[model samples]
Target: MSLDTSLLPNNIFSLKNDEFFQIIKSLVGEGLCEILKIQSINSAENLIATDDIFDVFKYDSEELIDIKNKHFFKLQNGQYLVKTGIKNSLLYILKLLKVKKEEQESLLNNNNHEEQLDTKFIINHPLLRSLVSYYKYTDHIKNNNDDKRSFLKIFIDNIANNLSQSNNHFRYHDSVKQFAAVLYILGGKNPGEQKTGKKTS
Candidate 1:
């Protein structure tokens, strides 16, 4: 069936401007991605216990409730029917990455072509989210190893072209300034003086 964008779940929307992204923020890295992938395979059941998911993962009620209001329907028995349509296409990509057995820069950048952010998908894409979750689960044995950090460094390096300050990926200082500006305004300092941190007597 062809996807009508209007009918698809909020999970597939751009994270930069989507409120659903913020609501589900608590679930990321806590196995919400894993549960979604598992549910994607069994299109028949379509139901899961959020409470039981904490058996292997962890979450508080508020975190669960936040996503529940948006991405799940509460059944009479309390199981959640996932509202997201995680199709076979996602499963195929997960399987393909499994076959690779290691991170590949080929998935990162096309050196033959110019890099452009507007022309490409954001880092929060469901597709990339699934692949990252797949690699993380597969590499569970090395979770605490120093090599894992090295692996991340290598992964970042592989896509470093897109992570530059010019691309809005690695402008750590700008973010710091923005954060400081918020604090300065909250402190009731003069806007011009906030930049220089000077006091006028």
Candidate 2:
């Protein structure tokens, strides 16, 4: 159970061990505390870079995964909305109090387990995915029937077809991106590389 956010007391000494964990949990639940290890990131930071996205999942902590689903953490835009005062207040308490020896041993053991699960850090970032998908499309096209059209032309044509399929119902501004996504298919560099992926809506 979490500590009631409204009923917080000022004195850390007054809280029990479980209550301490509860406060920490309230500040940043589950494995999110491990995020502090990555370049000493604090919970209050507003933006998370693409490269650092993997670090957030580096440990594959089930706790991290659980809390990540909370609406405040918008992984889609690489924005994490941590609660106010988390860094200067309760998080400082974590540093102030020494962990029990048994808990320390348990954490070390968990770290070893986390180290073995490398798949957690594999990012679903845009550039990597675009490269992968583009290459796969090229490989498939190359292996099958010959086509004279260039890769850029082929993908651009595909984009055009998709746009026309909806009778150009997509808004003019959004259609701009729908058309632009073809350049990623044809190996364009960093056209708003980190976020927007819209097949529809």
Candidate 3:
């Protein structure tokens, strides 16, 4: 008997900006990306939980070959976009990460498991809120280690700079602000800043 792969579950994808932002914020808020393990990506059962939530990325049947090649998987047109195999793998990884973070948080009461934050400073700043949300929600979905590290550096720099510029109350003076000192490091171009303009040489 031949196995029918089409009978399997498909995890969905969404491309809407609002939905994208919502997913991004939720992942950052959950804090799973900071501690998720690579091995969890292989968990099969985790793949099933995302079946309904993953179908947001639909495809054009006219471009079936190109879509399959670009997405690195195959799927039938009109099938809920989430149930395809490659998407299933991605969802499995995300679901496993989400569950793992929840487990970690539950173990933290009266324990030193949670990372310490300076409480005297303003915690309700908009950027800070965004950062915390991003940190928590992206915990499960950010799978690239290098990308995560880049994100962490950018996140820290952005938060520190915002706090410093908002008011003089928070102090990090005398300490070198290599990344935060210049706007260029964070990829912003100042009015008088020179632009070399992407020359490979």
> What ranking of all candidate models by TM-score puts the best one first?
3, 1, 2
TM-score of each: 0.22, 0.19, 0.22
lDDT of each: 0.44, 0.47, 0.43
lDDT of 1: 0.44
Model 1, C-alpha of 4: deviation from truth (Å): 23
* Candidate 2 deviant stretches above 4 angstroms: 1-63, 75-81, 98-201
Candidate 2, 52-133: lDDT as tens digits: 3334543445566545444235556555554344334434433333233234458789998787653333244665556556
Clashing pairs in 2: none
- Going through the candidates in the order shown, the clash numbers are 0, 0, 28
Top-TM-score structure, candidate number: 3
What's model 2's lDDT at 35?
40
Best by lDDT: 2
